[model samples]
Target: MQVHNRRATLTGTVDSWLDRQQAAQEAHEAGAREVNNHLHLLHMALPAATAQ
Candidate 1:
């Protein structure tokens, strides 16, 4: 994460959209006036489930 002029810039990947929103929320809570969320969502395939 990079912080300059009360703006927080987030970089890297997140598993879900919720995580991305949470990151920005945390930044705002930490006194960031502006947030530049450059987080990319990692699209990972889920494993197949076995039949019962």
Candidate 2:
């Protein structure tokens, strides 16, 4: 019973970690896309930027 409880605790901890990691990955990806979109919009607005 003790071993079983320990296993359960470890599993829960690992699951939580995985959830947090996935969320962080998603947030990072979203931020990167937002930055890219802003840059693209800026490039479109400025013709001089396109020349460089």
Candidate 3:
């Protein structure tokens, strides 16, 4: 995460869409006027047993 001029820039991988939204919400709660969420969703392959 990078912060400049009250803007929070987030760059990383998240497991779900909810996580990305939560990150932005937390940034706003932390007093960030602007939030740039550049979070990428990570899709993990499930194990054979789990896939079933």
Candidate 4:
């Protein structure tokens, strides 16, 4: 009984930890996408300059 209870607790904690990690990864990816989009727009808006 005690072993089962311990296993259940550990499983719950692991599930919660994985959930948080997934959320963090998703947020980081979203931020990176936004930053990339901004940089692309900036480059597009700049006039082409010839190097001497």
Candidate 5:
């Protein structure tokens, strides 16, 4: 019974860690996408600025 309880505790900890890891990865990807979009807009504006 003690071993079973320990196993259950360990599983819960691991599951929590995995959930956090997934959340972090998703946030990082979203930030990267936003940065890329900003860069693309800047890139598009450069030609107009140079023409002026």
Candidate 6:
């Protein structure tokens, strides 16, 4: 019985850790997208500025 309980606890801990990891990955992807969008805008505007 004790071994069963221990296994259950370990499983829960691992599940929680996996959830956190997924959240972190989603946040990182969002940040990367924002940076990419900003870079794209900057690139688009550069040619106009240089022509003047």
Question: Which model scores highest in lDDT?
Answer: 1
Instruction: Quantify how close model 5 is to the true structure by its C-alpha RMSD in Å.
Output: 17.6
Clashes of 5: 0
lDDT of each: 0.96, 0.30, 0.95, 0.32, 0.30, 0.30
lDDT tens digits by residue: candidate 6, 1-52: 0123222111122234445455445545544321111111112223445555
Residue clash pairs of candidate 5 = none
| Tens-digit per-residue lDDT, 1-52, candidate 3 | 9999999999999998899999999999999999999999998656677554
Off by over 4 Å in 5: 1-15, 32-52
Worst lDDT window (10 residues) for model 5?
34-43
- Which stretch of 10 consecutive residues in model 1 shows the poorest summed lDDT? 41-50
Instruction: Please provide TM-scores, in order, for all candidate models, with all chains considered together.
Output: 0.81, 0.30, 0.81, 0.31, 0.31, 0.31
What is the overall TM-score of model 5 with all chains considered together? 0.31
How well is each residue in 1-52 modelled by candidate 1, as lDDT tens digits?
9999999999999999899999999999999999999999998667999899
User: Would you list the clashing residue pairs of candidate 4?
Assistant: none
lDDT-superior candidate, 2 or 3: 3
lDDT for 28 (candidate 6): 50
lDDT of 2 by residue, 3-30 (tens): 2322211112223444545544554554
Candidate 4: deviation at residue 8, Å?
32
Q: Which one wins by lDDT: 1 or 4?
A: 1
Please say which candidate is ahead in TM-score: 1 or 2: 1
Per-residue accuracy of model 4 over 1-52 as CA lDDT, tens digit each: 0123222111122234445455445545544321111111112235689899
Across residues 1-52, which tens digit of lDDT does each residue of candidate 5 receive?
0123222111122234445455445545544321111111112223445553
Off by over 4 Å in 6: 1-15, 32-52
